[model samples]
Target: MFALYSGSLAEPGDPNPYAGGESLVLPKLWFAGYRRMLRVRIETGPAMQRYRAASRLN
Candidate 1:
């Protein structure tokens, strides 16, 4: 099992509660022979930034 947390702050002065805070839970893979070929990358920085911008527009 894998647990991950990602958060971002829009502004230093402005404290937005809904800025960007997400929790992701990933289950472990029990493959018999595929660990070496499998790869995973988690990059949520850009997505979080976009979300903050959209919120401001609305």
Candidate 2:
């Protein structure tokens, strides 16, 4: 669990990383979220369509 957050933990109650790390969050989460976002965008961003198509076939 600790390793999973490698760098996404929002400290105590904040969702934002430390001050110097603010910029890194977007790119980091981008790559993290981009995996699914990419699969979705491959068919069209917010790719639930692709996911749905696959699910229907299954």
Candidate 3:
């Protein structure tokens, strides 16, 4: 995890070493409600539609 944040895992010659990082520090106020926003997006997103369709077929 430390390696990822520090861009050590990125390819040696790549121009953007930290291109795909998925972790960061947010302000306390922003951090508090971020997950709820993500949860709502996931529940209503196209992936949820695909999941429901597959479950019905099963």
Worst 10 residues of 2 by lDDT: 3-12
Quote model 2's TM-score: 0.25
Q: Which residue pairs show backbone clashes in model 1?
A: none
Mind giving the per-residue lDDT tens digits that candidate 3 earns over 1-58? 4433334333333343333455343222233344444565678889999999999998
Candidate 1 residue-wise lDDT, 1-58, digit = tens? 2111111212223333332445222211222112322222113366767887899999
Residue ranges of candidate 2 with Cα displaced over 4 Å: 1-22, 39-58
Runs in model 1 with CA error above 4 Å? 1-44
Each prediction's TM-score versus the true structure = 0.25, 0.25, 0.45
Top TM-score hit: 3
Cα error, residue 16 of model 2, in Å, equals 19
List, residue by residue over 1-58, the lDDT tens digit for candidate 2: 3322433333323332333454655545534443544444465645677788889998
Candidate 1 TM-score, C-alpha based: 0.25
Q: Which runs of model 3 end up more than 4 angstroms from their true locations?
A: 1-29
CA-lDDT, candidates in order: 0.32, 0.46, 0.48
After the best TM-score superposition of candidate 3, give how far the Cα of residue 45 lies from its true spot, in angstroms: 0.3
Clashes by residue pair, model 3:
none
Ranking by lDDT, best first?
3, 2, 1
